[model samples]
Target: MHLVTGGAGFIGSHLVDALVESGQKVRVLDNFSSGREEFLSHHEDSGRVEIFRADLLDMNAVKKSMQGVEMVHHLAANPDIRLGTEVTDTDLKQGTLATYNVLEAMRMEGVSRISFSSSSAIYGEAEQMPTPETYGPVMPISLYGASKLGSEALITAWAGTFGAEAWIHRFANIV
Candidate 1:
């Protein structure tokens, strides 16, 4: 089974849909901060989907969700960008630190593969429009962007140190 964090949110929910349609068993761990239950309501009885309502900040919760899962789609994060500006610690806890918790859980559970949801914001208004993934000297401007970049770094280190594999996607604006 594959575990997807924030599986009830916009992008994550659609991911769940596709996974289910493809006949893949998917388990979702979501705190429901901005994720609506309606997004996943159709899958409640689909048997291919299992939902766990929990926060990634709790390492125990993350570990529990990791049980018996082979891969993780790490999509959970604080979605409100403006909130990050007002609260300095928001991204640190919800984005960066939460990713640490997920990585640690995956490590202990022996799950080696992770697909992290990074963002184009990590490029931080680069001089090169339509930047490539190999763009040098990544500098994030917003707290949200910085946290996502930090999470990407953590995933990279985890992959190298633990002999795991990771796919990081730098997504552009949803709309």
Candidate 2:
């Protein structure tokens, strides 16, 4: 079984579709802050998809959702960068703290593998057009970017300390 956080959003919902097509059972944990249920409505009858409407900030809810999960696809984050500026802690709470909860819950549940949806914003104001993977001196210009970098750090730390498997994919703006 696969667990996808923010699985009702555009990208996450599409991922759930692909997973279901591959004959895998998926558990979707989403808060609906930005995720729309209609995106995942197609899967209602399959029984291969289970939707858990909960926030990642809730440790108990996160833990409960992690039950019997094999792999985790963590895509939940504050999608609005401008909103982060208005609410200073938006990114910190939604991105960093939420990621921490997921990792901690995973630790307790003994779920090792996690695939994180990171962003190219982490390489803020890069000198090059397409920043290299080894780009240095990452100085994020936005709170959203900083939160992503922080979440990535946390994931790496969890992997190193607990022997967990992690895949951090830094996605660029789509078209």
Candidate 3:
């Protein structure tokens, strides 16, 4: 079975659709803070998808949801950079701590692979227009970016020590 952390959000909901179509068993963990119930409502009747309405901050809940899952797709995060200024700890709790919970849960469950949704914000005010993965010394300008970078570091360490694998994708604004 596959686990999608933010499986009720825009990107996550779409990913669920594709996974279901491909005949894969999917389980989702979301707090509905930014995600919507309607996104998964259509699949409610389907037995292939299981929904767990919980926050990533809850370690026990996260661990419970990760049970029997093989691969994980972690997308739960506060994407709004503006909110970071007002709620200083929001980025840390949602982005960093939440990711930590997921990683720990996966480790305990003996799951191996993970695909993380990083961001171009980690690069901050880079001189390079089209930044590549090999970009030097990532300097994040906002708390959100810092949280993502922190999560990346944690994942890297986990992969090296636990013999796990991950694919980190840093997305740039298309428009």
Best by lDDT: 2
Model 1 misplacement above 4 A: none
Which digits, one per residue and each the tens of the lDDT, describe model 1 over residues 1-175? 9999999999999999999998899999999989999999999888999999999998998999999999899999998878998999999999999999999999999999999999998989898988998897889999999999999989999899999999999999896
User: In each prediction, how many residue pairs overlap at the backbone (N, C-alpha, C within less than 3 A)?
Assistant: 0, 0, 0
Q: Local error of candidate 1 at 17, Å? A: 0.5
lDDT of 2 by residue, 30-146 (tens): 999999999999898999999999999999999999999999999999999899989999999999999999999999999999999999999889998779889988888999999
**lDDT agreement with native, every candidate:** 0.94, 0.96, 0.92
In model 1, which range of ten residues has the least summed lDDT? 129-138
Question: lDDT: which is higher, 2 or 3?
Answer: 2
Worst 10 residues of 2 by lDDT: 166-175
TM-score for each candidate, following the candidate numbering:
0.98, 0.98, 0.96
Query: Cα deviation in Å at residue 130, candidate 2?
Result: 1.4
Candidate 3 lDDT at 99 equals 93
lDDT of 3 by residue, 1-175 (tens): 9999999998899999999999999999999998999999999889999999999999999999988998999989996888999999999999999999999999999998999988899999998878888997899999999999999999999899999999888877523
